[model samples]
Target: MMTTIAAAVAAVALASCAGPGSAADDAGERTLTVYAAASLTGTFEQIAADFEAAHEGVSVELSFAGSSDLVAQIQQGAPADVLASADTANMDKLVDDGLLAGRPADFASNTLTIAVPPGNPAGIASLADLAGDDVQLVVCAPEVPCGAATERVEQAAGLTFAPVSEEQSVTDVLNKVTTGEADAGLVYVTDVRGAGDRVEGIEFPESGSAVNVYPIAALGGSEEPELAQEFIDAVLGADGQRVLTDAGFAAP
Candidate 1:
C-alpha cells in the first residue's frame, strides 16, 4: 500500500513539473493548409517544401485546383488556412464573400501561350492556327482564370475559337494537348516551360492584351492564423519570388 501511494505521488510531481512548452504539447501541432490555383502547382509545391525545411516541426498541406473551384470549395466549408488564386478576380470574389482574414496581395502575373504537341504536330505556328476547323483544340472553361484571360485575348485579337473540349483547369487543357487528345490548347507560359520538350509554345502579340495577376490571402476562421500568415509572408518574400521567377512566372 505504501509503494502504490509513493508511485502516485511521484506521478503527480512529474505532472506538476511539466511546463506549457513541454515537448509532448508541441509534437504534431504545427500544420498549415494552403489552397492554391492549379497554375501555381509547381512553384507552390517548392515553396511549401522550403517552408517546411525552414521551420522545424511544421508541415504544409497544399490543395491545387482551378481558382474558381477552390473558391467554391472554401465557400462550402473546406478546411484551409490560406488561399492563392490564379487571378485577382477570383480573390476579389472571396474577399467580397468575406472569406478572407486579410486583404489579398498580388504576387505574380502570367500570360497565355499556345501549347502544341512536340514538333508542332498541327503546324500551329501562331494563335490564328488554333482556329482552323480541322485543328482540334482544348481550353479551360470560361469560368477559370486562364479561360477568362483567353476570352480577353480573343476579343483583342478578334478571333473566335470553338475548342473541341473545355477543361476545368489549365493543367487539364495542357494534358489534353500533350496526350494527343487535342491538337493544341491555350495554357500559361509557365505550363509550357514546365513541360519542357513535351510541348512547344507559340508566342502571340495578342497574349499581352490579357495577363493574369495572382493573389494570396489568409483565410478567415483558420485554426492556425499565425502560421498561415507566416506561410503567406514566405511566399511574398525574396525566396518565394526567386522560386517563382525560376519557374517561368513574371514578377508582379
Candidate 2:
C-alpha cells in the first residue's frame, strides 16, 4: 500500500518497473519509494532505472519536491524507502529527529548560478547585474537549499537582490526564466545545464561561497529496509557517481 503526502503540497511521483525477491508484496511485486530533492530529478531518475534493472520484480517510485518539503512529509509519516536531500541542513533535521535508519552519505555537490532567458534578454552578465531594479529576478525561497546558497552568495558578493518572486524549488525558478516570466533566476548549475537551451546560464565567482552537498539515506520508518539500503548503495556507487557527474553535479 503506497501512502501519498497531502494534496496541498503534492509531490510528483514517477514509477519505473523491474524485478524483486522474497520481499515482494503478495502480488509478487515490491515498490521502492524514494523521496528526492527537485534538483536531483534528472539524475535520480536515471539512477532509479539502473537500480530497477539490477533488482528484478521491483518498481521504483520517485517523488520530487523541495528538500524541506520532502523532510516534512517523511516526518509526517509519509511512506518512503529512501530520502536524498539537496542539502545536509534539511537532512540534519531528520537526524535530529532520529528518523534515519543509518548515517547519511554525501554523494554530490552543486553551486548556484544565474539563469537568464535565451539571448541574454536582461544582459545579466554578473551577480551584481541582478541587483538592478530593472531586472526581474526570481529565486528559491530562503528556506530552500538553493535559497540558502543564494543568501551565502549575496553575503560573499556583498550584493542584495530584490527578487520579483521567490519559488519553492529551483525548477520553479528555472521555469520562470524559461517562460520569460522573469528576466533571470537564481538556480543550480546543474539545473541550468539540464534545461538545455531553454535558458542560458551565467556563472559567478560568488557561487563558490555556498556550495550545497547532496546526501542520501534510508528512512527509519521504511518498510523495505534492505531494499532502501540497496538503493542508497547504488547512489553511492560508481555508476551513480558517473550519472551525477555527467549531470553537472560535483562529486562530494
Candidate 3:
C-alpha cells in the first residue's frame, strides 16, 4: 500500500511539473510555415486564425515580405511550407526551379493606388500629380511586384515619376506615406483599404492597366505537404475569398 501511494504521489508531481505549452504538450502540434507577400498581411493573418481553429493542434507561422524577396528566400532553402506571391512573375521563378508541389492557383487580384497622408496634405489627386518635382513620392523597387505594377501604370498613363524613395515592399511604401515621410506613395488598393483612415487612397483610371494576380501553392520540399495544401485550399475557399474581397482584393 505504501508503494502504491508513493507511485501515485510521483505521478502527481510529474503532472504538476508539466506546465501549459510545455514541450510535452506541444510535441503533437504541427506548425505550417508560410511565406507570402507583404500586401497580404492582414488577410492572411485572419485566414491563418480560421485555419488554426479548424485544425486541432495546428499552428501557422507567416512570413511577409516583397514577392521578389520571398522567392529569393525560398530559393535559398528557407523552411517554408507554402508560398503566396503577389504576382505570377515571382511565382514563376519558383515554378521554373521546380520548387512548388504543383501549379500555383491564382486566388486574387489587386491594383495600384496612390496613398497620401490623411486629408490629401500634398493634394495628390492623380497619378500625374505624383510626378511633380515638389511632391515627395515613394514607390516599391522595380524587382518587387508592386513596383512592376507601378511601372505598368506609368506606361499606361504616359508619365514618369522620380520617387524620393524606393522600398522593397508595398508595406514600406505605405508606411512612408502614413508616417508623413513622403507626400505620396504607390501601394496596393488593398493596402490602402487596410490602412483605414491613416492614409487617404486616390484611385486613378490607369490602375486598371496593371492588375496583379496573386497565386498560392504548397512548396515541393515541405515536410507537411498535406497540411500546406490544405491551407492553400482554405485560402481559395469561399470564406477566405470573402475575407480577401472585404479587404479590397478582387476575385481572380
List TM-score per model, in order: 0.92, 0.90, 0.92
lDDT of 3 by residue, 128-203 (tens): 9988999999999999999999999999999989999999999999999899999999999999999999999889
Model 2 per-residue lDDT tens digits across residues 19-90:
343222447678999999999999999999999999887999999999999999999999998999999999
Residue 31 miss distance in model 3 (angstroms): 0.2
Superposition error at 202 for model 1 (Å) = 0.7
Predicted model with the maximum lDDT: 3
Candidate 2 accuracy as TM-score: 0.90
Give candidate 1 regions above 4 Å deviation. Answer: 1-28
Reference-based TM-score, model 3: 0.92
Off by over 4 Å in 3: 1-25
Best-to-worst order by TM-score is: 3, 1, 2
RMSD of each: 2.3, 10.9, 3.0
